[model samples]
Target: MSPLVADELAQWAQYIQSATGIYLDGSKGYLIETRFAPLLKEVGTTSFGELLRRTQVDTTGALRRKVVDAITTNETSFFRDNSPFELLQHKLIPDLIDTRNRSTGAVRPIPIRIWSAACSTGQEVYSIAMLFHELKVDLKRFDVRIFGTDISDRALAAASRGTFAKMEIDRGLPLDRLGRYFATDGQTYRVKDEIRAMATFRSINLLEPFTFPHKFDLVLCRNVAIYFTERDKARLFGSIARVMAPDGTLLIGSTETITGICPQFEPKRHVRSVFYSLKVNGS
Candidate 1:
């Protein structure tokens, strides 16, 4: 394939932002080249511009999906950062249950709905499921449903499989927890049925308008907004606020913030971690 020229890079950057809301400036020209090079060869395109054009005109959307899969970064692991899960295990889950018990009563099964946005390959979703088990949260007493969504179909497929290679299991997953939650299959491990049953996966574009039938008690949109532009970031969080329960909590990347971007959410701190809640008025 020929080199990706300035014009082609600009067009690709624009197209990527439009389709996936991931901003790619001129400096990221090499990224477009590096990520799309394989697709170029597979599609028999001689140049980056040709590949972009093919993707745009492909009616089946198969090529477009491939482009999305190739372009979007799926960097994730089981409990990627320790603090958020720690917060969930120590504060969020307990506090949420206490709040729900008051309204629904102790006998009724309290619903705990969670959304892990851009949940690449299901690690975060499974991590949360494992926490419920570790806490000995009675599944009969608490109806726990963890929803995981991402833009890449490839990523979602891997997530749905509930299987991981040895390297994947090594990152952030402890040995004791692994033995308890995963079934060994040669060098690979699969999440146990009990843990797998607690979560669901789907494909969703956060930049586009979306709605859910029910409001989530906790939503984790971590490490994804940095890819989007400021306007899109505001739009993204605004939409998230709508689908959140009145007393719901939102967790973003440790390095990211919604402070100036979205006024609907108010930050709350617990130990070393920070999470967001809908302001009383905002809710």
Candidate 2:
């Protein structure tokens, strides 16, 4: 495999950071080389530098798309973290439902929109669908819409298909829930259409302006912002706050904190997990 050239690192890193808001340090050159080696060989490029130059010259942008897809991390699994989903099942969703029920001017089919930002390969999105299924929420009475978005077109394509390998199904998903929510086909599993219908997947760059027509009731932007610089993190959470309902809930990676990043949200502890709710008056 060809190594990433020493001098090309800064140029590639800057381009990646500028395009995706994902900071790639010098140490990540090996990662870039490993990911691109196959593509480099296929495209007849002998060095990463040559490949980079070709991508720059490709005005059609196909090579650029391939480069971007290679750089974006798509690591994910169903219920990858138990705390947030547990919080959703035990507290958050129930509370939101109660609030919707109590509203005097509530419309028929209470609207429940959930956005899973950076939902790579659809695991988290499918997991949310399973959560609702387990809750036995009468879907006929509620307009529950789940949106899963990621910057990688390749990831979104896989997510939209709702298929998972046996290994992926084993990770973080309980055997019984897996049996309940998915249909086995040979060694792989596919999310059942009923659950699949509850969610939609699309390519979204969080750094870009908001394009979704409606605000969400619950937003899960987990484990993704760790890649962004502090400024990008602030912009991301700020944008999320703008599109989140005042009483809406946000779940981020367990180790991630918004204290110094975005002040629009206040951390709220629930049992073993933490979720944020938009603070009134930006407190």
Candidate 3:
């Protein structure tokens, strides 16, 4: 395969941003090369520019999907970054339950909805489901629905399978929890049916327009936004704000803040975590 040149890099960067809202600058030429090398071979393209041209002209859109699958980062692990889950267990869940109870006293089958945006490979969704199981929350009394969405179809397909390799399970997943929540499938671990049934996965592009029939009580749009430009980041968060319940909690990457980016959300702190909630007035 021919090396990725400056012109090809610029073209790919623009195309990626237009299609997926992931901003890649001149520095990412190597990333484009490395990620697309295998793809070029599979597609029988001789160079990055050839692959780009094929993707553009492929009316079936299969190549475009492949490009998206290759370019989007799907790196994730079970309970990756411990603090957000901690916040969910210690503060967010309790607060949500209390608010629900106060509004509708002793309502049976209380509704709890969560959206894990960019939920790569389903680890985060299952992790949250496991946390709820560990908390001993009565599934019979809660209308719990955890929806996981990502732009990559490959990632969503893997997520829907709820199967993980041993190496993946070893990352941030404890042995005891693993035994309780997963069933042995030869060399891999499959999330038990009970845990698997609690979540659903779909393909969604956060940079594009979308709507849910119901608003989420907790929204986890973490880490993925760092790849977007400032304007796109604002657009993404602003869209997230509209789909969140009035008192819903938003957990971003530990290093991220929406302080000036989206003023509709105000920061709140727990023991070691920071979460956001909508201001008194809606955005």
Candidate 4:
């Protein structure tokens, strides 16, 4: 891997940030050098400069997606943060059930939906499914749905399979849950059939045009939005708001909150952490 040429650097910078919301700052040179070196070699490109030119100039468009896919970071784990799930288990679900039961409407379970936007692998989606299962809650009554989407077809393809490497399974996932929900296969652990059946995976780009099939009871747009520009992030949240049911809760990453950036949500305390709840227009 030769050092990227000046024009190569600029083309890659603009191409990546425009296509994906990842803004490459100064240290990005090393990322390109280190992470994508093997990709260039695999493509039989002699230098980063040539690969960059092909991606920037290719009318074929295949090279462009491959480059973008290579650069996209897909780091995640099960129950990455535990507080929100604790709140969901102890407080939110019980209160929601009580509230719904009080209504003199249908004597049936309500539609419960969750959207994990940019759900990288199956871990987070499976984590939620495992959460419900731990509660010993029967899914026979409720219309439970979890929608996991990512821009990368490659990522979504892996996620939909519900398989994890031993390292991935060891990371943050509890032993008790693992024993119950997974089956060992050499170096890998596959999520049990029951958990895999609970969630649906699809390919979606936060930057491009797309629509949610239905309004959700909960939306977890988590750590993924930190990549977007302020304008893009605002637009992203606003579009998200269109599909968020007025009373449904949206869980963002602990580090990334809508405060100042997105004003549609009202801050509320749950499990000693701050979360944004859907707000009623002050009227």
Candidate with the greatest lDDT versus the true structure = 1
Q: What are the clashing pairs of model 1?
A: none
Error of 1 at 251 (Å): 0.4
Lowest summed lDDT window (length 10), candidate 4: 98-107
Candidate 2 lDDT, 50-152, residue by residue in tens: 8888988999988888988999888998888787888999998888888887888878888899999999999999898888888888898888999999989
For model 1, the stretches where C-alpha displacement exceeds 4 angstroms are 104-107
lDDT of 3 by residue, 140-245 (tens): 8788899999999999999999999999998999999999999995799999999999998989999999999988999999889999999999999999999999
Instruction: Report the C-alpha displacement of residue 203, candidate 2, in angstroms.
Output: 0.7
Q: List the residue pairs that clash in candidate 4.
A: none
Residue 240, model 2: Cα distance from true site in angstroms: 0.8
Cα lDDT tens digits, model 1, 40-99, are 889987799989989999999999999999999999999888999999999999888778
Query: Each model's RMSD to truth, in Å?
Result: 1.2, 1.2, 1.2, 2.2
Task: List TM-score per model, in order.
Answer: 0.98, 0.97, 0.97, 0.91
The lDDT of each candidate is 0.93, 0.89, 0.91, 0.80
True-vs-predicted CA distance for residue 275, candidate 4, Å: 1.6
Cα TM-score of candidate 1: 0.98
Clashes of each: 0, 0, 0, 0
Ranking of models by lDDT: 1, 3, 2, 4
| Model 2 TM-score, all chains together | 0.97
